[model samples]
Target: PRRIVAGRIESGSLIAGDEIVIMPAGKIAKIKTVESWPVTPVAGRQGAGRSVGITLDRELFIERGDIIAHASAAPRETRRLRARIFWLHDKPLAKGDQLLVRCGPKESRATVVAIEKAVDPGELSSTENKAIGRNHVGEIDISLSNPIATDPYTENPRTGRLVIEVSGRIAGGGLVLSVDAGQRAVPVDIVPVESALRLDERSARYRHNGAVVWLTGLPASGKSTLAKALERRLFTNGGSPILLDGDTLRAGLNSDLGFSAADRSENIRRLAEVATHLARNGHIAIVAAVSPAREDRATARRIADTAFREIHVATPAGVCEERDPKGHYKKARAGALASFTGIGNDYEAPQAAELVIDTSTRTVAEAADEIEQMLKTSGVLFDEVVDLAANI
Candidate 1:
């Protein structure tokens, strides 16, 4: 008979004669009687930090790592553990590696089944597996060598946990969140555009053809002007283009925000979300904004997906100042407006643009003509009609 050195509840509600289950082994036993403490026959729930000893009614068998749980709320057994691993190891974790895992007072050996994907903590993007270095968070799946009594992390954090230890050194830490049902992975195969479009017939009807034109540049740099011109051209050619101008959107959608860096980033993010919605509905969205930051633009590009086309209005700052139709430059230079882009703040030009228009050298008509030509060449527009004729 193994002598089990089990501790009693110091402060909670369990009392003598209550049925209990020893975890990990799932052994049941009955509480005999209170061995210590003046049995204060309290009526209400047990208060904090009151240690009480209990004698077992049967020859109960348990161990050091075993947990005493209420019989009604006994821990469930699980073989698979899905977790978000915070990788601290210099070397990335590979599948089929065996590691010692510890959860609270319980320990077990777990084998890595799959490293689904790595995510950046700052941006939360699924980074390339080869690019996953130290200090990265990633979702992973693991299979335990032995069946362990556990719960999902959402249910119990204390019992649902794991620590990866390799060669007596802690490599990473994670929490068990889900149990995976073995399923086959789908093979990567190209899907024909026609078949894909057939899946969403309403989207095709509304959008005509899925397309998104993202126009980004410095403030007063003619991004809105170019976008409007392009929209007109697209409309004349039987294309329904949705224009999302930053200034007009800010006036309504983001009126509460200021021109701070964080606010500007948020503004771009919201715009991206809106553009995604319009594009998914099958309308060609023409986004015109002085989206000054590269990171924000990258976020927009990612959300826009395959339909995204970045159009850079490469208007010079001096030229923009000269045409400052809103007098924003004078106000910014006079210190009346703070955090004004181009004058007092930074504006990152598009490193890669599908179409770059220098408004200084090109007129609005010429810019519009270039966009129409691009649409025709790209098969987005089928008609050879000029801008005026297309409008009719």
Candidate 2:
């Protein structure tokens, strides 16, 4: 059977051969033909406000409320939203209330997450109230059980306006302000803006290419000390640098993760993302992490690509245990810490690190100096005068 989708074009023109995405479900199909009732002379194209029937190149089970949009500009799919609504029910709209949301042709169950502000429509006065009185306007946060295809009301009035229904009766109406809290657009078409400053220009200014200096080893192996020393030295040379200490990250960004192998891998992956972002923006990102697994380090290297420098702080397990600043080695020795690298767990040493420093023998400053020289030799740190002359 031939499936025909009939609708009015709300905002944009649609024509035959135009590729379209069905929202919420995120299905992609091309328009095979555009049809008008009574066979108008316009064969291929139809503009906004015109009623039309479109046939797809492929079959899809599209619901009556499904939205069709250009593949380049698909609507957001989110379970959360922020909106401004006017209350019409005799009862006040409060947080934790469950209601039906009707936007365009789609309807879904929604819960009021929060009432940010309530304003009396008659007096035009605002209050920090927990509920919105009848005939009052309220800015609210809503959570949905299922994802919905929507746009901000300021962007598209036709698709952004919604009504709240209680027991199948209209109780309120609102405009979607934004898709809030962890919602992303379907079709994954987000484009990143390129920085106006070029890498070469940044290098000429800093005399150094942005880089991720990853120091990986067992616990208490002097990775953090060496990383901090290197960061200080780089900054002293007028280079932009940031230290990403493992303990600090675990205490904050990666705090939710546990000590499981999967969590450790995820930790490294996230660190790589952050470090690579800094490196791309022309900062020396000094990372000090145990990063016990070789595969995780490889993944980090892959993420940083040419900007990665793996330095293994090769202090032996016995020496690291003796110098355990946090008493982690003591805990491991007492069987209080499971999966402790170089004790309960294994620490996979890097086979092809850019530099190997046995911190048990060398002083912290000497190790920093050796690593700095390696960076200079690898062209990561360029001489300022030479770089300026080359740019000329």
Candidate 3:
């Protein structure tokens, strides 16, 4: 069904045949027609400040909360925002407060991540505070559950102003200062189109449930070796398996990331997302990476949920350095590689891993056998019983 987007054009103009982009979702379409309150002889275009209704060339999943703009000049899509706000509620505004952030027609559930500073506008003074008092101004960081399309206040006032709602009532208003660069939009940030195939159908056909097998450890700790062996074992057993090695990902999907804490976290987040996507489609995702931080691994677990299986490759650092298949340990010791796990850096081992393997003493086949058995025990891998049932 065709939808007529009704709104006042804060700036620019919309003409028939003009390509427009729907924000947040990034759906693009052409303007098919424009309607005005006072019917004009020519209703092909509507200029700024005029309220009108415009229909697109084709139907899209547009909502009341979506912004329509010129495709070429679309705003940034981000979940993290920095803003200066005036708290109007009697209750103080505190960090971690849950609120609804509304900018024009778009609104999203948000959390006050930080209270950067509280200001007493009347006294022209400011101080660091955990909360902002009633009628006071504050600079804060807001994290949204979903990304919004917005521009900086200085750049476009129309899309930069926001209001906070607490308990369905307006509690504060703000102007967006900037968007966190690290939390900016990625190519996969658009709304997802669901697949038609059902998970149970895939499971019934494959005769097994999909899962993400995450192998995390230090460099040369035999993560890749064990991952390869496990992949071969799963494939030989008639299971659909895909291996996602860290080095290979770095050379492609994660090439933009580095060894910094933030980069590492982003790298793991992307890997987890990709692995989860694969697992959701009934494929075993075998991931081997030196995901150092427990927090990052936890995030991955949250992403993969019940499909996640964390396996800590507990190979000793001495043995890892000795093997140093890639000479990373020597480089780290020579100060050539900084923050190298098991050397210059620290690795937080999983406190509650599903399994722990010390490759220093175990053969590749042995490690793979243990993993396969674990999968069987967890019901992720189907056994001969399922095979016989399928044959029947």
Candidate 4:
């Protein structure tokens, strides 16, 4: 039997016949063969993101949750680990709650054994609580059911971080602080490897790279209207952009969701991921959603990771209620709706949005123009000649 390779090898090289060490078990074995199925066997070495099944010279004892590395430099094993985590789910996390943590091929049954403190990531202030709510940060201690290989996040982020999976979905992400003293000896950072494709290759074909323009505000704040108009503008200018409106997405991508806090956070989180994918593929993603929570918006920005701009649609609820384009606010006020933001729930106005446009004062055309100008100034629309010259 062979073991599946998780992430691609980033450092060093794995060759056939090389002595290998499996983590947590500390078992040493010889690599009999490395097979890349449905194709030729791996000749000598493999890179990241490629799938490979490794057949050990002999089965001493091994299974999943084992880290494969060269024998000379094996990963350390530890049961107790500290981490800083961002909570993304609506449910509150309390001590003694059992969960699953996964990083690459390593997964373990983990329990929240201690709650050190809760933090508001936006304000960088600590809050006292026995539990951490959705969209907050928790500095906590976790105990794994069994020892797993790990390095301090400061040392190598690939093996140092884990995703907290509640149920089957990703509920949060954690950054390992340390295995012993819980002290960061070096700066904790994930270094990105630049794409091999030249910038001109993408821009010449699509006119731009993936850029996200996020519009946040109350429901019926004319976000969709502006998004449509902006989509038209970009398309006419020989660009490709897609509009991801909240209501439209709800009817399809988010049909199971409701107006609950957790659902709301999940709604934004899913949209952010979709938008990020679209943007990375050389498409413009214009998102018009009532991402009411500040924390949710922050999560979107953090996930997008490139050319993302937040435009605050400051249309007040009173005006939106009067328009009642969808009759949502009206139903909400009549007690027909629960967990309605700007009514039962709250909409946090962005304090430092890139641009603020009030639909009551400005028409959709004007807002669209402002958004386009903002993109131009932010260099999302790069000059083709300059791009090719720099990359080539």
Candidate 5:
């Protein structure tokens, strides 16, 4: 049976007199005639992906995966494949591991054979092999078991294909290399449907820019209070900022989660998703939680496109205990509370905070003023506001 492959035309359309090239298995063919749902006589009117069939003027070799286009638009061929693979396996991926890759009508058994580089998807920088663990995306170079038809992903997405299978399970996924033929990596912004909806809506709503301000501190260390104060400040300045406090969101958004480490991470992840959505819509989002893990904070920052400002409400533990604002800290110390961030659990301070507020020393008004100043300096507050704030 003849293979019937359907692909969108990448360039100039088909016409009776137009010249075309089929590549990877490079061959030249001239168009004898064009056919589609409706026939038209126009020559130059053919465009990308109009679903037209072309009758070649000469009998030439053409195959299912061969790219047919103008000679100038033909994609370059490469033997090696570079890609970003998202390892879904629980055992993690290592260098020199063999796997199968499927691209278009071609398939090859490839050896991951070498890890040219590893990356923290959240950081987007080259890092040493800690391990490509479950759910982590990393760049890799693979030696194909056999050379097959291939093209740069940038030129034709459909032709640049890859799949990694292990133990009879699909372990990873990747896209063909477009930028560097020597290195393979996937786009960093891959997310599920709900996340895509949030990102799309947020970007459309916020015309200028949007971001989340993650405020982290111990309980009674003033996270909620500071977040509320900041929200009010932004509102008065004609900005639409949403505030998501730990106590408030826990009452609804995260009520199902418990206080274990895994549960805590999930809770923060949900909040980050919501904050990312709000920020994408052009609303400044203030998230007040004791997101005690550095990894959790990094996840939030990675998801928020515009800016992720970590504000450490650096109120001393002594001061927080004295205030006994919620009496929760006392309970935690007395073993009445479990999974508390500061008393029993750990709180990783932001190593790269954009701003740190010593709430113990400064009044709410003072901290708000400082934040407004920072925003002005960052050029988000606009000139008019800066002038007014300066005058005040």
Candidate 6:
């Protein structure tokens, strides 16, 4: 349903013989026909104000925000750029601001790195500055997360003007100045793919497939207790397992981090990375953390991607407060503690968890047994391990 309704093609019409390429994706194609709004062939007779659609010789997976240009004159591609920004937002546009930058058929998330000069419009001359105030214009350097196909505004006015958005609202605009060429990662990003010793090879030795059973809920909600018991149950049944409790990790690997939102995100990211690698190597990782935020847990899901199951220890907050083994709830109630999961920061319960176990209604062994059954039904346990699971 996307039509390239840009300027008309009077002087250089895209007829059947012309060779063109798509920007950002440099795929070449032959021009088939140029049509008007009602799908009638324009035959290279349209003016500069006309908007027409062009059909290609072959089908391509072209998206809405894609530019079709001549193969001989392909546009510049870059990640870093200097742009003259016309600030329209009420608040000052400063460094480190993440904005959606849209220029012609290119769009990406751009971060303001440095504000070179701000022109107050009245003064006419430029002055050194770090931010652009409302109704002001500034020259700034921005970094894009992905390389974009662009051209200098001086060369092409329509393809170089950019609109910047903050939180889904258009806040300002920009005119392209110069672009630094595409960058390459210093350490490289490729990982080893071919492996003779794969997951199946490792699992054959352990007699059980690796899995991560993440127990998450309010603090003192029996998540750790059930995880520990499940870890022991797997170990007793001739399977290897490791417990990654929140308290234990906070004491060591995540000791330097705090309970802030950013810190919590990093903590969960690190845990998921570690668990994913461990699961790939045929080791069961039983994580017992009061991962209060559902979004954080969702991030963990993406990181692990496979062989991961979220088990919700859905013990009630009242029950957790009553069974506050660490006395955190009491301290929070007495104004002695901050950022307490159950008391201070409200825990966001998993809306669609794989399994939900309430310790108030079931013992630790029963909760662990339920998880073991889930693992067994999901094929995480081998035939021999299944027989031993019942015997244990």
For each candidate, the alpha-carbon lDDT, in order, equals: 0.70, 0.86, 0.84, 0.77, 0.68, 0.77
Question: Against the true structure, candidate 6 has what lDDT?
Answer: 0.77
lDDT of 2 by residue, 1-392 (tens): 77788888998999889989888878888999887768732475688999888898876767668889999888888778999999999999998887778788876667888999999978888889999988899999987755679989888888899999886699999999998653557574223566888787788778899999999999999999999888888888888989999889999999997776556777898899899999998889999999998877987897799999999999988899998899998898899988788784478899999999999898998999899999999979987453555655
Collision count for each candidate, in order: 3, 0, 0, 1, 11, 0
lDDT at position 109, candidate 5: 54
Residue 211 in model 3: lDDT? 97
**Candidate 6 residue runs with Cα over 4 Å from true position:** 1-185, 189-196, 384-392
Residues 1-392, candidate 6: write the lDDT tens digits: 53443444422335545677766656677777777766577665344455677777666656556666667666666778889989999889898776778876456666788999999998787888878999999999988754577777887776678899876699999898887753311222122344456666566566788887789999888888888788888888778898898889989998987776546766887788788778877899899998887867987887677788999998888999999898999999998998778874478889988899989998877888799888878878766633433333
Candidate 4 residue spans exceeding 4 A from truth = 1-199, 383-392
- Candidate that scores best on TM-score: 3
* Residue-by-residue lDDT tens digits, candidate 5, 125-154: 777784687877887877664345556667
Q: Between prediction 2 and prediction 5, which has the larger lDDT?
A: 2
Clashing pairs in 2: none
Give lDDT tens digits, candidate 3, residues 251-359.
9999997775556777898999999999989999999999998877987997799999999999988889999888888888899988688874479999999999999
> Ranking under TM-score, best-scoring first?
3, 6, 2, 4, 5, 1
lDDT value for candidate 3? Answer: 0.84
Judge candidate 2 at residue 4 and give its lDDT: 83
lDDT of 4 by residue, 1-392 (tens): 35544335645667689887777666677777777767746687776656567677664535556677777777667777888899998898998786777766676657788989999878889987799889999888887754678877888787888899876688999898878554322211222355676555766766766788899888878888888899999888778899999888999999987765456766887899899877877788999998987867877887786668899999987888788778777788799977777784477899889899999997788888888888888878754544555555
* Cα-based TM-score, every candidate: 0.48, 0.54, 0.58, 0.54, 0.48, 0.57
Looking at model 1, report the run of 10 residues with the lowest lDDT sum. Answer: 183-192
Model 1 root-mean-square deviation: 22.4
lDDT of 4 at 153: 84
